[model samples]
Target: MTAPQRPRVPRRALDGVLLLDKPLGLSSNDALVRVKRLYLAKKAGHTGTLDPLATGLLPLCFGEATKFSQDLLEADKTYEATMRLGIRTTTGDAEGEPLDVRAVDCDEAAVRASLQRFIGEIVQIPPMYSALKRDGKPLYEYARAGQTVEREGRQVTIRALELIACALPDVTFRVTCSKGTYVRTLAEDIGEALGCGAHLVALRRTGVGALTLDHSVTLEALSEATQFERDSWLQPVDALLSTFPQVCLSDDDMRRFLHGQRLKLSSLTIAAEAVNAARVRVYSAQGRLLGVAKPGEGVLAPERLVVTTES
Candidate 1:
């Protein structure tokens, strides 16, 4: 006779964020689910989506940490990308079918010169094989059916783009850019500029805002650790808001703040040069992070308040 199935373990309520070093070939959500199951977290979400072909730092938010994940989503990102010159793909990456191939005759100097043209603010059309929606359907769905859609070019800033290495057909580089920047499109654009088409062969995200890959933990490492050891990898929820300026509230103000009430500027321990109508990280007198608030006129209004239990 077959043994009866064991009872499922109860999921524990978990808070804090995990800097996951996502592995290649797994979608961001798939990776999040695996990590969530490992932690037995009651609530969890990823800050941003990474393509299955890409790998590296993926910030996973849990419980109250999900409240401020938008901060990281809006933050700038850095990546190390490898592009194969002379070959273009339908999806702009290696996963797609090859579309075209041309001779690659450009040297490093010519390639470097071409990359300079894309350094500043430039308009880029979103790729068809993207998650962008059109009339309630993803662009990729239409693309899969061999349909083409008109896409408006969006202006994105490329703060830094450096060519790290160039070996005939393969060109590797690093890029630091604002949110919404598409590196695959960038490779294609650069290839077009060099008189040869190109497609992304490999991509790895190295940094997201203030978070870097160095502090991230891999799935294998988490899987090998004990439950308590895995929990140790989580950073406090407030770690997401480290970039925002802080404002401490008095005991009375803290009480009001927690109740979702507005507080006067006089009640806050703020800097004299604090900007008006600026978002500030709110904290109690004990230095515990309360949440995020916005300054308006002479009052501090709650934008997102952390649950006390999670705090």
Candidate 2:
């Protein structure tokens, strides 16, 4: 006899962000799916990606929070990584196939000096095994097909780099950098500068914008928790825009702004410093986060608007 099917859980609309401590071996999307299914979330997205070889803070957004997820992409990031000297890889990480190996001739002094050369503004050629698109296809696809593509060098800023430990063949370091900075490329570049090639062996992102790993919860922890426990872990949607200047609009203005109308800057109480900002967070007088706006010609024009929850 055929067995009866169990009732399926209905996906619910959930709003807020989850600071997930994404475990290694799962791509950012893989981790997001697991967490979304756990919550039965109707919609969800990640602020940024963490490779399967990386493990650390990956903020997942659900419902309204997803609207502001793009903001974090431009936020500075901090990572702690370990690179093996005298070795180069196809993917620039431990997961890649080793291309070559040599002797580790450089000491900590040499490593430190090499790292200094990468500090501040520097250019990097995006790796072929990256997600960068060429002709509507990811570069990784081309790489898997054994095809090489010429990529433009991008300028990225390295805010700081601190060597944590130097254990001869293995070097551990912490780096704070601007958006679009690739730690793997930095490791490879430093390796080349030291007269020996290197590739990332271990990597953990500790910070993104204002969020830190300390505030993140692991998938294992979430699995054991009840629905209420999971709900409690969700950060307010506005948390994603903490770095942006905020303006609380009046009830009339809130309605107009929500309806896609622009507001006069003279009528809104805006900080002088924020007037020239590229984007500003807009909120309702009742403390509800409205959305984001772009300042122009003494007016605040709606950019990305949040859909208000139904009554």
Candidate 3:
């Protein structure tokens, strides 16, 4: 006979965002699982994927916060990366075997000039060993099978690419770029520009949207904290929508919004300029975040609203 099974603990309906300092070698999903289990959260998601080779700030969304998580995914990202010159890897990073090696001959001034060339808009051909999918399968799967597929060059803006340090074969730099910018491919391009092929050796994400590494907690710390203490680390749901304009409504109007009704733009007390925005965060008079709304010519139509027990 099978032994009696233990009772399962009910997951909590938690809401908020957690800035995780993801450790090297841990995939973002694995880290999210740990945070979810630690908080006993019923719903959870991450703003973006941090590769196993990277280590740094990874924002996690719980419950209501998940509603606005997509906003962060489209925001700018910042990272400090180190690339080893004179060596090119198949995957464009240290994780891959060296495909080519040469002597490093570029100076710091030359590195600075090369960085300037990528300061604005640039095009990149994503590597084979990436999460991009084709025919319902990730390109990485095709790469593992030693197959190459055609990938078009995508236009990605490199808002800023500043050199941090240069020590012969290894070069460190900080980059701020728009969403979908592949830094590994960037390092390879820069290396080729310098006449010395390179591969990424280290990467640490420091910022996403308005969130930064300054207010992040490591997994090790969360493991040692009490459940209540861990809950305190979560930012309010509105944190994910910081860049969006906010519209506060009365209890009665909030009820109407909950029922998928629209309000006249003239009825709102916000500044004239804000009413014209594409999206706005809707909040109840009692300071509760209701959800989001899109402004029409004269009406504020509900876009994505919070899920409530009553509705």
- Give a tens-digit lDDT track for model 2, residues 43-102: 999988998999999999999888888789989999999999999999998878999998
Clashing pairs in 1: none
Candidate 1 lDDT tens digits, 1-311: 99999999998888798999999999999999999999998999999999999999999999989999999999999999999999999999999999988999899999999999899899999999999999999999999999999999999999999999999799999999999999999999999999999999999999999889887999999999999899899999888887778888878888888989988887666886454636888888898889999887888889999886634
Q: What's model 3's TM-score? A: 0.97
- Which window of ten consecutive residues has the lowest lDDT sum in model 2? 302-311
Q: Judging by lDDT against the true structure, name the best candidate.
A: 3
Ranking by TM-score: 3, 1, 2
TM-score: the better of candidates 2 and 3? 3
Give the number of the best model, judged by TM-score.
3
The local lDDT score (0 to 100) that residue 169 gets in candidate 3 is 89
If both were scored by lDDT, which would come out higher, candidate 2 or candidate 3? Answer: 3
The TM-score of predicted model 2 comes to: 0.94
Would you give me the overall lDDT of model 2? 0.92
Give the runs in model 1 whose Cα sits over 4 Å from its true position. Answer: 1-6
Give the TM-scores of the predictions, in the order they appear: 0.95, 0.94, 0.97
Per-residue alpha-carbon lDDT of candidate 3 for residues 208-288, written as tens digits (9 for 90 to 100): 999998889999999999988898899998888888888889878888999999888788787655687888888888888
